[model samples]
Target: MRYTLFFFLLLLSACLQAQYKINLQINAPKDSIAYLRGVVFDDKNYFPKDTIRIKKNVVILQSKKPIVGGMYYVQLDKSKQRFYFILENNDNLSLEIRGGEIHSNNPRNQVYFQYQKLAKSFEVIDSLYDAEVGRGRKFSYSDKAAFFKVKTAALAAFRKKALPKLNPSEVLHIYFSALNRLDASVPDKKNYAARLAFLKGLDFNTNKLLFIPTYKELVSEYMGYYPTQADSLLKGVDQILSRVNCQSKSYPYVLNYFVQLMRNRNVQNNTEGFVKFVNTYVEKSSCNALSATVKKTLIDDAARLNKVVNLAKSPAISLPDTTGVTQDLHQFAASFDYTLLAFYAPTCDHCQKEVPEMDSTMKLIESRLNLSLGRFYVCNEPGVPQATWRKFISDYKITTNAKHVELPSVSDIRTQYDAFSNPVFFLLNRAGEIVARRISPNTLRKYFAEIQRQRMAQNP
Candidate 1:
């Protein structure tokens, strides 16, 4: 009888561990569609985890499997507005979202939404200030004095009220949100700096929080807030590496985070940071600290990034143009006085807008001088459909005068050019050397104009 009772208890525990309940209610139009997206990594890339069809304006995301604790978003259709929440403890969690407001049983999400409400209120004050300026009226000191007083009081109240009661997980979410706040347009930098300093000193870098999706994000934003110069940036990377245990799983995760960040911005001397990081840490001792795959990726990415810094000879690539005829990039580029080597993707909305602007500007530049600018539009490796690419070209009315090539199978294309996003532009001279890389099309026009003026000055 004792042994049978023990087995029954064990089975009950197993059944309890295997299930989770997540409930969501959104006050939107009936029959609206909403998706529950899981946030992966600090980059906050969302993947659709579950879908809900709103019936009578409510849907329960019931699951028999345990839901992992992380950040998640509830997105409606294709709208820009998204409701974000943190899942903790993963038992009987409930969220009720109405319009832009979120109500939840979770205290962490409640504090987050409260803060959002305060921020929205502040935006109203900001719009009033903007309206004053728009009318060509001189902003009086009295106008902002009231706003500043209220803003200061409200922030102090919120921080004092919300922060002390939070668990480590909840505190980390607030820290992540605060770190990502825009500092460029803030009216009071001194007060903001103090808040940031307090946040930076928090006890966040623990082994327990390492697996949390927002952990590295907090660290990344904290590091980014400082380190305005290249040397400082290099030291910042070293500091992060030294802080985390190399044996821990977070070591490689954090390493990959910084590597990808630098890779995305790897143009001109910006590539120096990534190169130096690899060289410093690529020794057998340090390399052994990382997983085999991560070490290999670091070595391979460094090698490719090293080859294409400003003034480096462009790497040789063979790819078929939109016409299906294979062409050598280096040989073809040699024929033009300058080649605007653009790496883009069809799915990028920003690329969709910018490519046409580039086409228009280049057309205007072509008529001015014998310096014919050839457009080499290289589609980066994303496996976007050929039909989508063709449709994009037709929709944008992209110049048929350019060579359009899709290199989806070429893994080196991303590493070689550091094409982390679409609409990356590289300017190559007749000798197939990169003159300027990752600048806007308007900036490219100014660059060419400067060169033209300099040539006329030198020759005359």
Candidate 2:
């Protein structure tokens, strides 16, 4: 029993001290260097992690620490030639490279190489298939549809047969499974429940799957397919995070993913929902994956979001009118039924375009909606001389002729209104309450037109 315990202790110590080794046999000349790089998020994006120097056609890359598991490749410094492999949890690997092909001792690497070959083979075969169906013939619509059906079936069959034979293990297995589901998804259709289950059951503990290239594409497709409504999308985000182990590295990766996904304005518009997501998940997560600075930034941004986007009434500020006299913003807007709060810069080309477009939009809102509207344009640069502000207003035809103001400093505009970019806009109702935040000046005409159309539909 004592001997058994001693052996167990030795094993544990060995595992703790275990390092990574990659042995390569290449045709490069002696004294040549190679770069060891890796893929983490997107397939096309790679970053260097280490350097390996070759002597006499051989190189051994060694590390004092356990290398993080991911897909890695070795590229020659002076040559376009590269040797790629998918590596994870293995103590050591040996590869013989020739003519852009790798023969690896590690089974995982062998399987991944096979997978790559399969992908390339199918791509070549697809083009050939396209030619076979056409053969210099212009395909009719039915001919095209028939060719697509046959090609898709053949592709699915090839994958189904090839993946099972490759026999990927651990995280690689999960990636392939998710990839199959992704392949099954089409532009107008998907298996939502099955995909949701896959995500819910995914063990992020092995977090190496995060490095798989198309993993993000799968997640993106799932996010876009399931959520038809904005609220549903936000709730879906929370639901996914709720299943994650807060202390696991997956928690922070998934959290930041949703943050990035929501950042695309074309995807979602419920800034309040995203702010609450950040406040809830970011503040409470114990993952320790994010740096202290990043966590603080997220929390600060969430607070700023609530201040700018969640409030019933936007905070008031005083700024100088075009005449250089201080004017109250909310007070100036209170008498009007609705207000167009615009932030622009004197020199910004985009602001120049957006501000002028607002003229027609403002006119449409006032004439069609039959509402009392105020135009309050704020110059983002507070210290800009009144002459610059007046000239910009004149050039942009701010002939909305309501109120044009400027702040005292740029920092105040950035922090107070969260106007980091030029041409931020808001639509506000009377009583100083917000109707919409961060609207495009170009969309305002269509926006109010839709509102009037809805009103007529409901009343008629």
Candidate 3:
């Protein structure tokens, strides 16, 4: 009898330490497919790990082993919409979806649902506030302002009280969500200085919160307000970086996010800010985890960017013109006040439409502005039939006024200009410096015309 009791106790402990089990049920039309996707940190896209088929409006998904603590989502294959949920090691949870909403027995999920609801309601109120300003009314929130004040205070109090009881994942979510509430509130009428100070005060140097995607968004939105003020913008970024310990995960996360943000926004006009950031944090960072490849890539990108931005002369291009005569871009047409270099491919659909419009616009503008135009057709010589290139020129009637060039080496051209897309243009002044780049031909024309007008006004 004693041996049997001991055996039973051992079996109970084994069961208690078993792998996580998840039971998910969906009440939908018959024969629906649900994809269970694994979550990636700071990425909105999900990759399916498993798929379950619904029969009689019921489908269950489970894990044979413990999953790493993070977020996961259930997506309907038919609708392609996803709903999020939290997962932790050895979590035995059940979720039910009905009437386009999810119900879960887990406390973490309950808190997430509550936050979502509150955020949705706050968005509605914020939209009304924006609508009033859209109609040209003074930016007065009136009753909404009072409501936001009370709501924000209550959220802060609730978060402070409830955060300790929640897990790290849930705490980060609720903390960021609560902080987001302050963004919608109306600022003081006489001064908005307090808002900037509040934004600067938020700490993002923790490693655990680094996994949350919203943290990057918060940093971006806060720093984006001072685009022209490079000093102010870098100051704001420096505040966040100051808290980041170089030895921690937050170092790479913050640095990489900063680089990607500048790249995406094309901060050429504010290159000083980019330069300052790289110098202060990137160069000075001696973190052991900072890999050599990443450092080299970052330095290389900054070098490439600096060369082509404003004062840097355009890279030299030596390719055969449409007539099979080789000519360098520097000597092709050196007399004009500005040269428009257009890079394109024959097979690109957007290029097909955009190239013609650009050709026509440049011709029209050249009749008035002192501008030169060159079209570089990027294609392999023998591989891409010469007939295709000739036909493109004939269709666009480009040869009547503009100089045409055919480039066989596509890789070198892409690297020199950092041309990621087709139909890229660069405007060079008479001195051969790149005065304007990555802008529409029409915008460049307007800018040139305005500059000429300003000059004439000064002379008159």
Candidate 4:
């Protein structure tokens, strides 16, 4: 009876052990072994001496030949703090963190350090992910906090002495990984400052060994995050741009940097700065050899910049109505004593909200003088379906006076008028001279009043 009880206890112990085993469901491609990297439980460990009981759900095992690519099962017990990865390869390329010792010692310390740092960072990421799973659409403040916490710890780890001995590519990867993690958190000016400092420390000038692709991505992300610090960012960009002297190889980066600079100037309303910057480029000898498309882009940018600077100084712009027929601005202006030409898009919500109010102002002025208001729904691009355009027009509930037509090109029109955003209104007198321009719904009333006063002064 004692012997029977001992056997029963042994069976019970086996059942308990089975209960602790985490089942992993792995789906791998044909002929490829799964390369497991993340956490796994004790029962799933693929170490040669470890006995792994494959769960029923785990199927479709593939060959481990060539071993570089595939999917693998990883069962991880978060509660028990046990983890393992089961590889299909019986040839012993598999690895596990058994008391901090890796498979080998030649550069194995570096590998182990990287793995441990990554594992810790991933644990934090996993926690954040769990916190975010159920909260839909709404901002997950707690998850954001967790993310920042993990990122801060990861950054601390990266700043340690061990990172310097690593390869240039590895060092860059670490810097950018931290940069990306911080970017997803709340925008902190301090974080941007720290990132810039970290980047400067890397001495990108000497470390051409790091992959160019990775370096460019880091630069782009830095540009995006620190837009307000344009001057500082520009200094970094200038250094990088100087190194990228091959125009054919570096034009894209240069073009994008210039574009970002222009946008930042626009945001700050530093129109004079924008004009000066572009003018310098426009006047450069290299500008002559630039592609037509690039030259045109520069011209468009310059014109827009010029217009913004001249907003309070310049008169209105009058463009022809491009309805069923084409007409020049001069011809169109001669027909009416006062012409209000408006460029708008049907899909634009701002245009939809503002156009009706503008139409009311036009009606008020129509009976007072030989004044007319005309709208041209400029096709944003060529090949926009007629049906789609018509539907957009109908959906907006715009009237017959507001005709639909396609502009030759946005860049051309914008350059000619110095217009930027839509539902733009321009006023012209009988002599085809521009009188005034209005950009907002609230400004329409003021524009009409000023135009009327001007007309009365001229006529009287």
Which candidate number has the best lDDT? Answer: 2
lDDT of 3: 0.63
Q: TM-score of predicted model 4?
A: 0.40
Q: Of models 2 and 3, which has the larger TM-score?
A: 2
In order of listing, the candidates' clash counts read 0, 0, 0, 6
TM-score ranking, high to low: 2, 3, 1, 4
Runs off by more than 4 Å, candidate 1: 1-156, 164-204, 207-217, 220-232, 265-267, 270-273, 281-291, 308-339, 343-354, 357-425, 437-460
Name the candidate, 2 or 3, with the larger lDDT value.
Answer: 2
Compared with the true structure, model 3 gives a TM-score of: 0.64
TM-score of each: 0.53, 0.66, 0.64, 0.40
lDDT for each of the candidates? 0.66, 0.68, 0.63, 0.47
**lDDT, candidate 3, residue 58?**
42
Q: How far is candidate 4 from the true structure (C-alpha RMSD, Å)?
A: 15.2
Better of 2 and 4 by TM-score: 2
lDDT tens digits by residue: candidate 1, 292-384:
776778777667666665447777777887789997778778888888888888888889878887888777777776667788888874678
- Residue 149 in candidate 4, Cα distance off native in Å: 3.2
For lDDT, candidate 1 versus 4, the one ahead is: 1
Scored by TM-score, the top model is: 2
User: Per-residue lDDT tens digits of candidate 3, residues 1-460?
Assistant: 6457545644654566756556677876733788877544365634457877865344434555665455677887776656777766677678887756787899878777675666566676677768877784653334545646756665566566657777545534544453554445344433347546546545565443454455565666555444423455576677667766777655676677776555432333344456556666666666654588877777776676565553488778787776788877777547565677777777778678767877777777767755555543444333567788778778877664467777655457667776656767777766667776655644555566777799799999
